[model samples]
Structure formats: C-alpha cells, structure tokens
Target: MKQDTPTPLQEADDSGFAVRVTQSAKSVAAKVLPVSSGATALLFGVVMFLVTFGMVMVFAASSVDSVRSEQNILSVVFRQGLFTFFGIPLMLIAARVKEGFYRRVAVWGVLLGIALQCLVFTPLGDEYGGNRNWIRFGDFVSIQPSEFVKLALAVWIGFVLSRKGGRVREFIPAWIPVAPVAILAIGLVMLGRDFGTVVIMVALVFGAMFIAGVKIRHLLAPLIVVSVVAVPIVLSSPSRVRRIQHFFDGCTEAEYYAGCWQQLHGTWAMSGGGVLGVGLGNSRAKWNWLPEADSDYIFAIIAEELGMIGAITVLLLYAVMTYAFIRIIREAQSPFTKIVTGAVMVWIVGQAFVNIAVVLGLLPVLGVPLPLVSAGGSQTLATLLAIGVVLALARSDRQSSQDGEAPEDVRLAVRAEGRA
Candidate 1:
C-alpha cells in the first residue's frame, strides 16, 4: 500500500526546521578558519634565516672578546649555538599548539614566571653588569626572569582584557589587583637596577593595552603621569643622570669619556662603515673599540662591518617583518591571536629600535638587546617562541576554510567593528 506524500507545509511544520538547523550548525562548524600551510612555511624560513644570520654575526662580533678571555674562538659561538639548538625546536613545538590550549595555559605560565622573578631576591640571583636580574642555577646555566616576564605580561593583559570585554576601560579598580603585581614585578627589577628590561616591559604593557582596545585617553593619562613622576627616578641615579647629561652635551670633552664612551665609539663605528661596510666579520669596533659588541652595540658592529647598505638592509628586513606581523594581527580571526601577535611584534621591533637608537646616540642607553640578533639565550628563545605563536595562529587561520559562508558570529563581529 502506498503512503500519502507529505506536503511542503506539513514538512515545514514538522522536521524541516530541525533538519535545516542541524545542517546549518554542521556547516558553521565545518568553516572554522582558513589555515594556510604555505604562510607557515614562509614565516618559519624567514625566522630561521634571520636567526642563523645572527649566530654568524655573534661569532664575528664576539671573537675578540672570546680570544682574550678564554683563548677559544668558539666560546661565544658555542653558547649561542646551544641557545639556537634548544630555542628553535621549542618554537616549532609551540607552533603546533592550538589556540584554546594557549589561552588555558597563559595564566599558569605567567604565574610560574612571576614566581621565578621573585627568586631574584634569593641568593640564586646573580648581579651582572650592574643588574641583579640574572638567576643562576649553576655557572653553566642562568635565566633572566625579565625575559619571561615580557611574555607573561602580554598573556596576562590579553587574558584580563578578553575577560573584561568592553568594560576594560572603566575605572572600577577591576585592574587594581594587577597594579600590585605589576609594581612587584617592576619593583623587583628596579631593585636590581635593570632599567633596560623595565623599559621593555613598559613598552610591552602599553603595546598590549593599545591593541586590546584600551582607550587612548585612558592610556595617555598614566603615560603623562608616569613621565612626570619619572623625573625623580632618572635624576636619583648618578649613572643615569650623568648619561643624560652627556647625551645633551655632545661627546666633545675627553672628560665625558666614561659617560659618553659607548655612544661615541658606536657613532664612529657607524660612520666608519660609510656605504658598503668594511666587510662581514671585519669590524674594527668589535676589536675592543666598542663595548657590548655582541649585545647592545651589535648594530654599530653591523654598521662597521656591513656599512650603510648592510645596516639599511637589516633595517628593511625588520620593516618587512613588522609589516607582515601587522598583517597577521589585522587579519586574525580572534581577539586573542590579534592582541598576542601585536604585543610580540612591538616587543621585538620596538626593542630593536631602542637598541639601535642608543648606539646611534639618538637616545640615552637602556641596554636592550637586538632581538634575535643579540647574544642572550633567554632573549633569543623568548622572541622565537613568541613568533612561533603567531605562526600557530596563521596555521589555524588557514585550516578553517570551507564553503563560501562563514559563521554568523564572525560575520556579525566584523559588522560590529564597522559600526563601532
């Protein structure tokens, strides 16, 4: 016996609604993001290339110091190689991690890092180069908690802003808890008298806040207030006050030697490079003429060795990397990815510029490392790990591509931005 056919209206009144809803949900789930493996490959290649170049330059710049200290030409190079060996693989592992996993782990990661920073007060922390920020497990291994603090602060700010939503700007003292935490962190470093790391952390906080949509008025208020308050901090330190004096006075008098020595030599090194540079690994500055040749003054060494063309090329590469990162943050599907990548980009490039500016005598020295190019293991690893997170975001982005339609939530959010 044949059953009677159901009418369109009957079906609509029955299972049509449920069926359509199920199909739509499935469709939305299918189109999570547009992941691009090719972009990931490109990013990895570029990062590795830059890192390798830095390793080579580290050897070139540190050779003289190494020979004088240890009589081993490979001393600094081997140490840098060790950092690369460990850091590169960790970066790769971080790149494969999922977004949700990162979010979940951020709080714990930051908390652990903060705990480590507190250890600076203990006997484990070693004072070096006038900064007591270094924590030594042994003579062979040491970690700079400030390096990890950068990531911690970025993650913490991203989390706080993400949770607070639009009310992040309001003065509820909801951010009050973070104040003590930040003070403790900054205070500990300041106790060590490591102004460079403090500057970096300051930049990282401001960068994260800006990208996470903190109001410009809100940001500028504290910044101005801080500047006003900081006048005493700068004046209180004899070394810092003297450096500032020399910066304005110009490096003319021989008596300014102690204060202006690094800047003066750095400028001479850069000037000596002229156009085509002396040659890679042929820097006269690295021959003990410039202090911190492989660290703060590496750029001057590059200018001396590679000349204007090389210096400009390195600058342009950094510019390209910055542009790429900005593109990644802008195109990111989630606020978490956007804020994280933006913070890291600012930290790396901003620090690089600060280091360069100090060497060029355009700014007072803060002793920040030149990101991937610097000789510090902690900084090299931290920077690479941060970039790797960006690569993971890029990977996840390319994976969610499906049909032409995206989720209603994504579509709605994009529209909201326009309206806002």
Candidate 2:
C-alpha cells in the first residue's frame, strides 16, 4: 500500500513546523550554552558540590537526633534533601531571569520580604532557639522570612546605589531612602531577636555600599551609630551579655557547664578531629553532646567527622566561591551587578566566617548557620537562590561582552568621580 502524496497545503504546514522546531532548538541551545562561562561554571559547580556535601553532612549530623526523636534516621536529612530538590530548580529558573526584571521588581521584592517577615508576629509565627523569625504552615513546613529578606535587602540596596551612580559619595542623596529602608529591614529581624541574622544583614548592606563606591567617611558615621545602638541591645539580653563576656573572659569550670557549654563542646569536637578527622559519620559531638549539630554548629560536626582537613576543605570551597564572585563583580559592566554580587558574597562568605568563628571560639556563638552547608531548609534555599542571581549577573556580563559592548571598569568610574 503506497501512501498518497501530501497536498501543497500539507507540505507548506510541514515546512513551517520544521522551521519552528529548528528555531526552538536554537533558542534552547542559546540559553543553555552561554551559561558555561568559566566563572559561571565554577560557581555552579562549587555550589552544587557544597549542596551535595551538605546533604551528606546533614545526614551524618542529624542522624542521632532523628533516631532519638523516634523518627527515621533519614528524617532530617530527607527534609533537607527535599528543600534541595526544590531549591535547585528555583535557582536555575532564577539564573535565567533578566537583569531588568530584578531592577523592576526590586522595591516590590523588599515589600514582599517585609510582609513575610511581619507574618512571624502573627499566629503563624513559630519560635525556635529564642528567635521568633519563622512562619509555620501547620506541622509540615516552616519558612524563615528573614532569609529571603536578606536577598531583598541586597537587591534593593544595589538598585538604590546604582541609581545614585556618581552621587553615591554624597551622603544625603545616597543614603536617605536606602538607609531608612535597610534599617527597617534589619530592625524587623532585630525585633524577632535574631541578632545573628541582624549582624549578617548589616554586613551585607555595608558590603553593597562599599562596592557601589560610597565614601569611607560616610560609612564611619553609620558604623558608629550601629555600634552605639548595638551595645545597649546586647546589654539588654542577658544571654547576649554572657556570650560576649564568655568570649572576652575565660570560661570558669562552672561557667563551662553553663553558658559556655556549646562553645566548649564545639572546640573539643574540632580538636578531637586532630588531622584527618574521626572519619565521616563517626562524630561523637552529634550524640546529644553539641546543640544544633546540623545547623549553626554544623562546622564543629564537620571537623569532628571529617577532621581538620575536611573543615579546611569546606573553607577552601568558600574561598573558591568568593573568587568566582569577585571574577563576576570585576567583569560586570553595571554597578548594580557589582553591588548585588558583592552584597551576596558578604552575606554568604561573611555568614560562613561568623559560623566557623563561633565553632572555633574565635567569636561567641552567634547562632548563624554555615551557608549552603547547614541542615536548615530556609538557609539552603535562600543561599541557592542568591547564587542563581550571581550566575545571572555573570551570564549578563558575558552576553554584553559578546554583543561587543566594551567592558566598563566600574571601579575606575567610581574613582574618577571621587577625584572630581
């Protein structure tokens, strides 16, 4: 049975369909292929590595607690994995979003963040470790609005400073709206009593401003003001005061069992790891010894199981990530990209530093988790989303260069303005 020949209309329709398919394939390739820039690829690889490593660590660290609570041994890690499952796609989707979209939604993003944060005060709010900074939806899910608030604050600050451009040196024009909005964001988190997040947000704002070329003299005044306000706030919390005192003064034998319990145990865990560590999944600290083994104090658990080498490996990964961020920032033609990337760098890397420092007793316990490596769903998702934004910025730079737009030296432009 021979098939009948196609009609002219049918031939025309088939040709059109083939052309459409070709166009679609080319479109997909264009989107997929350009994401392979050295910086973007390095960043994407490093983030995925940390995320996978985090899942392994979270399983190791939370297994004991999970079993003790009579839940499956994989319960905590499974939830973390679920977050990762959702987060990765969100990250990739975010990475493909255009720069103009971020600029257009910058203010609305802040407002949405603020609205979510305010929900923490309502009936849906849940308190954990003394910070009422979470919004819970029944027994299954809890959201930390502060985590996304950090992202919004970074984007908003970047937008504001970039818009100001040369006037970033002038305090009033640069800071009026930016300062109040940032302070409000930070103030909301503070009201939730999460001093750790507050500190990270402050550093994030400062980092963005510095990258946007705000003058040092202008920064100093805000630093003083924050310090002054911070002192009284620290003093008001007895727990905060004890933590500060413990850091400055030695922990007495009695105090060690009291206020310094977590810090002392964390230090012991790190030292116990010696060189190569006790071996993965062999952490003694996770056996009801160290509090927050899978979250804020996860680094100690990392040291205990993987040893100094493992701990250092984690640090090196962050260093590599920082390098990728710097590469993107340096290559970026837009002030907004530089500022956003810098702020995110500070938020992730700076928070990691704070978390590790707390573990090593270099600083008092600040209750901050290691970004992308902790068991917290909110933290992991937020960090991955932020990373996606950086990737988008890097891709934007590459696309700009490919279009033959001469790369502008953002720093040089800022310096020229300063000289003027």
The numbered model that scores best in lDDT is 2
Superposed model 2: Cα runs more than 4 Å off: 1-36, 405-420
TM-score computed on alpha carbons, candidate 1: 0.85
Q: Cα lDDT for residue 304, model 2?
A: 86
Write down the worst ten-residue block by lDDT for model 1. 29-38
Local distance difference test values of all predictions, in order:
0.77, 0.89
Badly placed stretches (over 4 Å) of model 1 are: 1-43, 173-178, 397-420
Each candidate structure's count of clashing pairs: 11, 1
TM-score of each: 0.85, 0.89
Q: What is the lDDT of residue 311 in candidate 2?
A: 91
Report the C-alpha lDDT of model 1 over 1-420, residue by residue, as the tens digit: 999999989987779779989999867643432224444444556677779989988998999999998999899989999999999888877777776667778778878887888888799998888788889998699989888888877766665565555555665533555556666777677778888888877777778778877778877877787678668877888988888888788776485457777888888899999999898888888888788999889888888898898788778878877877777776666566667777887888899889888888888888889988879989998888887777776665544434344423245445655665
Best by TM-score: 2
